[model samples]
Target: MASWSEAVEAAVRRHVAAAGSPFTRQALIDAELDAIVADVGSAGATPHQTLSRELQHLRDMGLLEFFAPGVYRWAGSLDEPMRAGTSKGVFVVGSHSIYQDEPERFYRFGPQWLPNASRIAGNWIIYQEPRRAGPRGYYAVAKVERIVPDPATEGMYLAVIEPGSYLELGRDVAFQFDGKAVERGLLNPDGRLNNGRAVQSIRTISDEDFNRIVGLGLIEDEDLLPRVDDPMPARVQEEHIPWEGPVDRATMLVSRTVRDRQFRKRVLDVYDCRCALTGMKLINGGGRAEAQAAHIKSVAAGGPDRVTNGIALSGTVHWMFDRGLISLSDEGAILLSRKINDIEGVSKLIYPNGRARLPGGVSRPDARYLEWHRRECFHA
Candidate 1:
């Protein structure tokens, strides 16, 4: 069995890997102290003191670096390419239609950035929308699996995204906060902005700055929580002020606790708690919708958590949809699989028009995801 100190170090490693680098002592304690105490069953030094001692020991072993009096940055290895001193990067994108960018699958780039993108392969990267291109600033995160030449476009390459690693930010992060650039790497030594670096299609990101952006982008929003049949409020106010100190809230970005909540909220809100297939809206006494958020591609299949990849479905309909008993076309036509035993009963549960009741505008399901469901999940 591992010693108490070894067990604590192991727990600490898990937290750092999930949360990314640059964490505070208090945040570390809050995230892992209870688990350590439960596992160790009372140490002479107290679980809190034991954690503190191990943190300093890890720092002395060159696995962590002190960022401030109370803050620590992870210096240990998380994986092969994410080891200490390995550089990550950012990928600048425009409208998906314009660049043929598939945010969940791959990023398209020109030969100019081939070298820069190569450096960050096998690591994580942030997706940004250029100022004049669109409103979203730092919008999402993904891990790059590899860099491959784009067969469709000459002199271009695609950064193949790691399966299931792409996650849209809970909130779009601004380029600057309180007159200071969030990406300090874009600022010159004299504090003037570097126009060249600012516009680069791909650029290296310091771990400190990367953690800061991830912390801001993943902060939970109560307004995005799941609601019943109520329409979402017209305007939800947000604060753009970025944290100027240690970044401690980075891990939950990839946590299912955060992603599932945001996904359910966005999906149900757009559908107005009505089943897309049956047009039935059922609310419980607590005012929660009976409809559940069903993913078209599913997380296990490398689908993103974006609303466009989700649908609101009654519990029975969701089960049928998941098991290939039913599916949908790009045009929202309901497709019934021959494998379904009670086709007549299933047919009665659908809308009279035999089409999905999709939300208006951009909230509707994407043709790519719908096509994926039809080709990959549908029995017919």
Candidate 2:
């Protein structure tokens, strides 16, 4: 008993939810043409014309963005079933998981999540590790550049992480606070959790809820590190206070102030506050670290704000490294550029073994980024 337009809208939603967005007009026809062909029976309008009309309806409703003559991008939230210019979402990541998740690089997901994933394209996502996975709860956040089919595996897709956007939370936030579910969307009428919502690997998050998580995760600790350009070193003390105020999600994620704070925290934690080149752990009388976190590939060059793309260095060494006077090999060997006028002075600053001190595992500097520095910035 549905009208032709109603049936067309239903079919289109199903097709897009399953197939994802940024799709061509022909692709939609191919997936949904036959499903609603009956709706146009005995009418002068062809099924193709009917589908096109409904697509235009969706565009007018602000659910779709027309990119060209035939291409369209879905700009609606799949979970909430609403339209918006941008949407925020959550990604459930597990340690040693089945899906390939490079916390700072990309996230791999199956076809079932295409709709939810598309909702957050070109937007931010909060990364959480389930209790079963590890101690880190809502551990980090990153932006999704785009969604593309995984070349290595059929039916799988990758949400490419935006460069210089990934940042580990200053501290892990627990799922429940005072035995109440933190995510309001997951709470049932009786104050119990809707387990069905909790199990989803990809889900949309309300902006208010997203902001709350950011506040809890990135609360300033007493021992905050100084920014790269700070004239004076941070004075540290032994105190930690939980943030109990509202945070504007946009300001927290997009502002340079928060990005630098989160980036510095991740890099320093990875290297244990030691200079990678000289193996020095210098702390001033007030307890502020003299070791500075340097971008292996800088932000200006589209480098990611990830531990893999960062290295800790002393003040003088950081200046030299930033100026193309020094670099690092994939294997952690120091590479001094020909531009250095005082080789002996620089030599004394480096480790005696002539290798940069690097941590093992995923925290090590990524070779691709190091290669970029050698190719684009390093003098020789």
Candidate 3:
């Protein structure tokens, strides 16, 4: 009969050994308790109840965090020396559940983890809905392959991670938890809806459940929230200003209005309701959906402020592409500059094989823009 603290310490050690490293609570269940229960006489211990109690105790001590439902790991163990030869453990966890009333909006929970320190990942769960499509109950996981700050919106950042990583993490968590942790909602079984319609109404533990769990010491509160900043008012490109000559202020204002509207519509129609580069769809007013029109060729470069020269892009990708950090080929393939690829983890931006999605009616990219990108922007 081991004491409670002694039993917990021993179980933690055994669980870590079996997992080959520190792992979440589910890992403990999968690797140790399930088998330990069946093998009675060797250790002659009640491993299941003992491990659960010990985990609860640890949670109360503020040393662990529940990143998602039933998923947890060490939360405050930094300051100790890094384990020999191991990269500093850093991971990003994003979880989403859908609402029944407003299917477009998704409740998102994301937290960053540092192997032994306070989880540094942003904590605030934001309500973001897909822009192009309604809530379809699909979810993904990816590493934070890139983080780009928004120039127009202070404190707003864009993150690009491997899509495959997102899918893999979703699958792994689903498999390990036997669907208890993730609820993808009821499928129609008739398969009546389109491909994206598979996820109708996914639900997870509610906010109350989340707070209760946290209160019980099941998770940590880092108080990190998604920062939202309003976009700056649109401005004419600096180069386009005729500063050397006497300016017709009234004429300029009228000309700008017509051009801006034309550009906006063309970009919207060309993107066909989503970002051309990232495939981010738009949602209505609910902070959950987003889609913004973008210019493929700079307005400052004599590109017509019309659909023929515009593209629809998600707000984030638009900023990057406009800055010449990302581009598309004439055939709608992704093009990354050699300089971009040189950055750590930038390969994730390649999108598997350089594929790009264009609107059905729009012609291929203009040769002039493609040439310009190649000459001035393409890393080559």
- Which model, 1 or 2, shows the larger TM-score? 2
Q: Supply the global lDDT for candidate 1.
A: 0.74
Candidate 1, run of 10 with poorest lDDT: 78-87
Q: Give candidate 1 regions above 4 Å deviation.
A: 1-85, 96-98, 131-134, 178-180, 188-193, 219-254, 269-273, 281-288, 338-348, 359-363
lDDT of 1 by residue, 59-99 (tens): 88887899998988877654322222235778888754467
**All models: lDDT?**
0.74, 0.74, 0.40
Alpha-carbon runs more than 4 Å astray in model 2: 1-86, 95-106, 131-133, 145-154, 160-163, 219-223, 227-247
Best by TM-score: 2
* Prediction 3 TM-score vs. true: 0.32
Q: List TM-score per model, in order.
A: 0.62, 0.70, 0.32
> What is the descending lDDT order?
2, 1, 3
lDDT of 3: 0.40
Model 2 C-alpha RMSD vs. true structure (Å) is 10.0
Cα error, residue 76 of model 1, in Å, equals: 31
Q: Clash number for every model?
A: 1, 1, 19
lDDT (Cα, tens digit) per residue for candidate 2, span 292-339: 878888888778666788899998999988888888888988998888
Question: What is residue 333's positional error in candidate 1, in angstroms?
Answer: 1.0
CA shift of 108, model 3, Å: 55
- How would you encode candidate 3's per-residue C-alpha lDDT over 1-380 as one tens digit per residue? 12344334434544543453347676777765533332211233565566677677777877565666666666543322122221111222223332121111111211111111111122211111232433312122222333343343443333333221211100112211233322212122332222222221111122332222222211111111111342543443223455585432213222443345334544554455666666667565544335565556565654433344556666666666776777777778776656554544544533556587775542345666666765665455
